[model samples]
Target chain A: MSTNPANHSTPVNTAAGKLAVGWALVGVPLAYGVYETLTRVAALFG
Target chain B: MGFLDRERTIAPAGFNRWLVPPAALAVHLCIGQAYATSVYKTALVKHFGASLTEIGLIFSIAIVMLGLSAAIMGTWVDRNGPRKAMFTSAMFWTGGFLIGSLGIFTHQLWLVYLGYGVVGGIGLGIGYISPVSTLIKWFPDRPGLATGMAIMGFGGGALIASPVSTALLKAYDPNSGAQGWVASGDAVGKLFLTLAVAYLVYMLFGAFTIKVPADGWRPAGFDPATVKAAKLVTTENVSARNAVKTPQFWLVWVALFCNVTAGIGILEQAAPMIQDFFRTSDGASAVSAAVAAGFVGLLSIGNMAGRFAWSATSDITGRKRIYMLYLGVGAVLYTVLALAGSSTTILYVALAFLIISFYGGGFATVPAYLRDLFGTFQVGAIHGRLLTAWSAAGVAGPLIVNAFLDAQGKPGQLTAASYQPALLTMVALLVVGFVANLLVKPVSARFHEPRPDRERPHEPAMEA
Candidate 1:
């Protein structure tokens, strides 16, 4: 059973990369939405 | 078709569990667009030459469809994996937008109802539950946190879509952003087309990326026994069919219905109610319209934040104890608001924020509670059936508030005293929910599947 080191690392690396990008895809928009909402929310006191 | 199968979606060893939350978020955020229809509502009313009631029916129909479809398709969603369910949801959702756009272009209201209301509503129902079971399975140790992150996206979805929809309308018609401006029907049609295409891509990404945990997978160093150690938490499996037969199901239903009802009492009337509460002797409101709008926005923040924060907190506090806070303390908060809310703005805002957060918390916490009571065997389906409570509350909450207000005076002219009756009614409802929560006990043995152990490992090839 020949297990290449690079092949073993590839799935792990891909999984890590996917995690970051996936969170960013949802997180960036949610952050923007929150920022906009906060700006309006600030007006409640102002 | 093969790619979307439950067997195909089973995760390989070492797949990152963190990736699944975003996948759930993608579908939720897209379906969350349902909340942003108000941005273009006036335009639709103007274009269709319909009454406000008629225009609003579009939203009403969609909500009804959401509850109905979720109840109908829940078991189906559980049988299939998240991948197929998410994909089907994406297709129906985008298809609704496309059909709705066509209706707008052709000037037909029924088509709009069929497209966005019935079809899009089904999308909402399926999409809402699609990722929940998967997220629960992935993080059985922290089911509250896992489900909270996904459900919070549903709340946050409106936040993103409202601004984006406004921007799209502004881009289409520069005057749409001006004071009291309504975009043209053509612009809204174009907006629908754009959203359908964009959401299709986004939801497709979510569907493809989502993977179920491999059979018997558990997070590192996590013990399943610890979860069942709590009094209410169970290691038993109850099929969705049997779950409905149990009194525990209806008790949770009452708790959810009351929580949602009280929250809607504040949400539905936040803008006008704030102004009404602070109105001067001669009918002038000390709170400006802009400030009232901001107050509504603040409540929205409370609503969204509560969904995530309170739900995650349940992971530590335990689900039943959290519901005690939501329903029991919720009743107390309503009492104070009804009694003294008129005295100060700060008191009113603070109390309303807390109540609404409990409302959101109730929503986010129920799935985990169901997981505790019913087990994960059909938690998604049970949760789906549970959402019918939301639909009932939606109608009842507004009716209760409005009926009392109508007895007092017209809109834009009422006072805080006028709202006291309704507010007190909510307090009573919350008490009922609190009692229901108190009465909740374990499901009887007969409801459990006949298997030796309820926490059966996933057999991907097994039929329901």
Candidate 2:
């Protein structure tokens, strides 16, 4: 249930900031994975 | 700074709801380690000298408990809200890992089940729904995208955990020989403790960071009319109690069950299926274990991507249309994967990737679908009940895949031919789900609460 708004916008993350943070959460870790997988793949080829 | 204080969680007028997703992600990413149960499965099998099935049951019990706890604790989540739910979740999940680690060290099998399976399962369920209702409330204009953001973390959670856990296990016991650093139960126990601490810290960040959207909050320049105009996207609220009584709920449940079960057809057998499908000359050699691992990784990427991509797309295409794509189009993908066989490596990879994406999409999309049909009032609880479908699929998918393969009379070095029947069976399951999705209609007005209760409802009256 929603209580009354304090009427002060906290604006913690700008729209762009929100999108950036959202993707970064997934992207940073996934990048780690991609790098890891590539390392393994290279070993397979080697 | 007091994380569990309810008053502290109220969003100010300018509170940007976007911060919520990262918070949700914090919890989900940690719990997603449950998917990486394989990271320790072999170690446990060797350490305990247990059958693979016995080791595998840890995952099963956790999954089944996830469904049960989510269904049972959903309303509690709604009443107490995400902050408390997430805090509670952190304790159980992190505690489960520690307790489970102790089980490994003690060589007690049931402790693993009790700690990881039962207790951790409770954490999984609570953590899963902790953000659903809050996200729905925050991003009313984009329910699908809101849920996708957090649920995608779940789909992607294992990506982070798998490597981290493996590295930790290795560090604990580097002298593991050819079997690698995975043979020692002590290392596994220590790894569990490491994970428990790491996850607790991350999830605490989530609980601390999370705040519910203010009452009656909406995005800038958004019009409620635009959403109300969509078909089957209701403006009415339905109690979780009444929601289960509705036909639409059952339809969505069936649809999710089928989607998950079909996806597990591959997920439950990712390694073996890949090796079997691409066997070498005269069936003497299959794909290397490394390649199979790579294939699983590829599928994981697809899975995570699908959760975001498809769920976001649902914002524009509408939830119903996306389910059509997931079920109707997914059946076609299964058929293609089955017919295409092990013909080419690229073909196999491509088809499996697509199927897995839809699988992840199915999960991320369902919460939004529930919000559409049932309203945010009880969407979390409804979503919790729906996860029971996942529990059922967890068992059914493996059984179907393994049984069909087993009945074919080959035990070892299974070929591409071994998977045809199961894949076809997956196609059939998708067909059944497609029909179920087709049957989903708007919840009838009779089930809707008469008034939109703005405050959380009081605890139920004791039945004498």
DockQ, all models: 0.62, 0.26
Runs in model 1 lying further than 4 Å from the true structure: A1-9, B177-179, B452-464
Please give fnat for model 1: 0.73
Per-residue error for B382 in candidate 2, Å, reads 0.7
True contacts kept of each: 0.73, 0.32
lDDT of 1 by residue, B1-464 (tens): 69899999998877889999999999998998887788899999999999988998888888888888999999999999899999999999999999999999999999999999999999999999999999999999999998889888888888999889989988988676578788999999999999999999999999999999988899999999898788888887889988888899999999999999999999989999988889888988889888887897788778888988999999999988899999889999999998899899999999999998898888888899999999998999999999999989988999999999999999877999999999999999999999999899988777777675454344322234
> How accurate locally, in lDDT, is each candidate?
0.90, 0.85
Q: Candidate 2: which pairs clash? A: A8-B14, A9-B13, A9-B14, A10-B14, A10-B15, A11-B14
Candidate 2 regions with alpha-carbon error over 4 angstroms: A1-27, A38-46, B1-5, B177-181, B452-464
lDDT of 2 by residue, A1-46 (tens): 1354563233323545765765576468756865775565453334
lDDT of 2 at B45: 95
